[model samples]
Target chain A: MAKRFSAEKYVAGILAGDRVMLSRAITLVESKLHSDHELAQEVISQVLPHAGNSVRIGITGVPGVGKSTFIEAFGIYLIQQQQKKLAVLAIDPTSQRSGGSILGDKTRMDTLATNPQAFIRPSPAGKSLGGVTRSTRESIILCEAAGFDTIFVETVGVGQSETAVHAMVDFFLLLMLAGAGDELQGIKRGIMEMADAIAITKADGSNKDKAKVARAEYQNALHLYPRAASGWLPHVSTCSALQQQTGLNTIWQTISEYLQLTRSNGYFEQKRRDQNLQWMYEAIRQGLEEHFYNHQQVKAQLPDVAAQVKEGKKSAFAAASELLGLV
Target chain B: MAKRFSAEKYVAGILAGDRVMLSRAITLVESKLHSDHELAQEVISQVLPHAGNSVRIGITGVPGVGKSTFIEAFGIYLIQQQQKKLAVLAIDPTSQRSGGSILGDKTRMDTLATNPQAFIRPSPAGKSLGGVTRSTRESIILCEAAGFDTIFVETVGVGQSETAVHAMVDFFLLLMLAGAGDELQGIKRGIMEMADAIAITKADGSNKDKAKVARAEYQNALHLYPRAASGWLPHVSTCSALQQQTGLNTIWQTISEYLQLTRSNGYFEQKRRDQNLQWMYEAIRQGLEEHFYNHQQVKAQLPDVAAQVKEGKKSAFAAASELLGLV
Candidate 1:
């Protein structure tokens, strides 16, 4: 077991931008131990005032989309050109099953890993999506309290994690490879619509023209979509992380414009407020479901009841009523 | 109070294809009274085996997309050309507040409404989305048991109801007005990806060319989407509900082909089973929330606690934990 710290020490250390304390606090938040949960919540509550100052961005793409390379380039750009402290975190629910995670090897983002202004945290292995999401959200707060001005929450684009990441971030960026058929990219349906911006990666050398064509096609497709509630149209651009690092500036410009529009219109603050309430309700739901499903009576009867419902031998509502009664 | 019948009588009448019995059973399912709830469950259980016989389709579009006209034409086509009995239902959770529903007026589909082979039901007024969805799902079973071979669940394209409709149907059809800017159609983002087919309405006379162009554009856009789990690529076509009623055949053909493909691939039955389990979990979630929110302590503390959460004065998970403790 990891050493425990008093809530006051953790709070003070996080407020004073101590990376070690921030990382320890995040580990506590991710812990499943009952005692750690109580201490983590106490630490979180104390540091709550210091959080919410950072711009949180969610970046996603299918495997082979060069996510690590893009993040490295973007992270370097933010620290050097933009002069922003950056926190990089990931949410990979499948990591537990796959036994490997996107950020498991810090070598993939070696420069970013070594940068003093940048902090990178791999996703907590062996946790369910809910557990990972909850911890990641708390980690963002911890990072913000540690004086990070920007947060990037990364997740694979092919699963349900994107929706969770989308809920917690201010901006959503999708990375895609040029020349690959969009259908062959393995992105889940509806993910493209959730993107605030699309970046065609590796847009250099021989791939430049194909990236340009893909960018125009995506722009047109985005045009056909309804305007987001933010009143900002989604932008599409091309960037090469390896050689030119060409389109990172454009992506940043789009995010800047989006933030300007939404903040000016008060949507940014309004959305954050809504997200807080939504998260509270979501937590309540998770708690209730956990309690009910863990009940001895419910666990014993669920399989049979579920089978009946699945076979159309019972109505879903009726079956649900029966299970709820058992608890 | 509406009259109540024995479960056996309701089951017998429904299996014998009595429309009046089906309507009465639907009324019972929609009732808010405690006694009615018990009786409704009993009736539903009895009719459960007789259900799942129909081809369920979800049809949606913005108000000006001529959804009612399209449904009227499509309903007539199914009953006449396909020799199938049809039931048309709407899910408008906003109906109570708006004081109007899509199918509230039978005259909207006068010919189809007057036909003995077609049954048209308006959205249940003054209920939550959950309530309406539950009753509509139950009603679909009742209609199927009453010998209706085709069920159309309709909803306004711009709200959360379409997702509910999509969950309960085998095929999802999106209606769009030709020549109108797609963004101006008020379609919610992420909805187009839910569709299995898109039909461009008002395609007769002067609108034909524009409809053809829109169809091509949508078809092209859809091509960029990942194929559905059913291995079906969504189809796009043009139809005229008023004059020639052109392309209705193509729409039906698409649904037929989709059914054939999904059924052969086992996705059709698997999806139904998955949907059943999903609905059961959804119902349990609703039940849990209703119980928790209605608790006296929770009701009294919610307003202030929610305000704190919204203002970021407290962490969402912490607030949820406190509230859950209160209950």
Candidate 2:
């Protein structure tokens, strides 16, 4: 049997900026055992005071959009040029069955992975079921407490997880390919609106002109969408991650301006506060669902009843009542 | 003291197409008292078999977009030409504070209100407390049982209620004006993508050219959006609610076409099934929050903790934990 972890020691180690302690705390958070959960909550409570100081950014793009290459160069730029400590986290809920992290293909981000100032943690099992995302949220606090000032959460563009990532991050960056109509065909429309910025990746050599054209087109299309509550208009730009001198500086500048405007107007703080309330409600909702769906009767009857619903043999409300009754 | 209402009486009356009984059943469902809940559930269970026969449509637009007039003409057309019974319902969460239904100004929809084939229920109090929407969903079932073949759930353009209205309806329509940019200035961005059809209202008289131009522009803009899962491209058209021979027929035709495409492709039934599952979960989430927030300790501490969170003196997750701990 494994020895029990001490919550107080974990808290002290994390607040003292120990990376091993941060990793261990994150592991505790991600654990599903009841004892681990109690301890994780305790550690999270103690570390809460030292969190919320980081600028959390969420980046997403569909497969084949050069997300890894872009993140590699951008992460390097932040470390070398801006001297910022960065943490790159992945939120790929689909990876659990595949036994791989969404960022398991680490060769694409080799340089950043080895950087002393950068911390890259692949999502364990690509995804966790139910309350698993609660761990990811906690991991953010642990990272922030350990002194990572710039945090990036990455996700694939073609899934519902973008909304989850959007809720946890301060800025959202969407990557797009130049003149790739097929790529757009696979992307979800709602993801586009959630993005705080869109960057056309791989804008080098022969792709430069097409990337420029794509940038202009996306800019025009974004104008049709309403301005964000923060009064910030999402920006579109082009960058080549493979270039010796990438266009990372301009991207950082846009982020700086956004932070300046929103922070000065108090939108940033207000958004974070709203996010907190949202997470609280979300956690409560998830707990309720787990309890209801796990009911002995509900588990036994769901499949047959759900099939009846799909065949239109039963009204949804009636079916709901029948299920709710069992609980 | 009034005699307790029998669930069996309400169910029988609803199945027999009694409007008064239907309204009473709805009232039972909407009642917040714990005593009414079991009876309401029983009544709903009995009425469920008679429901699911109606075509539900959701209509939304800013206040000045002539939604009432449009519905007035549209409802009349359905009855006179299509020979369909219609029910117009409103979901106004904000109506409570204003002391009336958002659509309490029924004079705008005078013809529809008085028409024998039409049943128009002004939203009671414009909104209710937690799970008010659950009752709205149940009211939909009662309306279907009462033999209304067409259902329209209307919402204001500028609020969060549109998402709720969207969930219960089969088809969503956005009513826009020829050049009402100011009216749309307050509208949110995602609502545009939710529409199955966009109608440019007030197309008669001097506004004809502007309406046509707006239609073309919107048509092009719709093309730029990712295609809806149903594979039916949202239609854009002009309509004149005040004109004797109006463009209402074309709008109906577009809706018919949408229904045909989705029905043939099986997306129609699938969407409804998904919506049912969604509602089940939504109901569960709402229930959990009501329980937690209503906890005596939580209710007492919420304002101060929430204020602290808003002021950035506390982390959101930590504040949430404090509230959750109380519960």
TM for every model, in the order presented, reads 0.92, 0.87
As for candidate 1, its clashing pairs are: none
Model 1 misplaced regions, further than 4 Å: A97-100, A125-127, A180-189, A216-227, A242-246, B1-9, B97-100, B125-127, B180-186, B242-246
Q: Which candidate leads the pack in TM-score?
A: 1
**DockQ score of the complex predicted as candidate 2:** 0.28
Interface RMSD of 2: 4.0
Can you write out model 2's per-residue Cα lDDT over A187-280, one digit (the tens) per residue?
Answer: 6767888988998888999999998999998998788777789999999988886663557988898888899999999999889988877776
The share of true interface contacts that also appear in candidate 1 amounts to 0.76
lDDT of each: 0.88, 0.79
Kindly list the per-residue Cα lDDT of model 2 for residues B216-288, writing each as its tens digit.
Answer: 9888867876777899899998888666345888889989999999999999988888887777656655655
In candidate 1, position B234 carries an lDDT of 97
Candidate 2 chain B worst ten-residue window by lDDT? B124-133
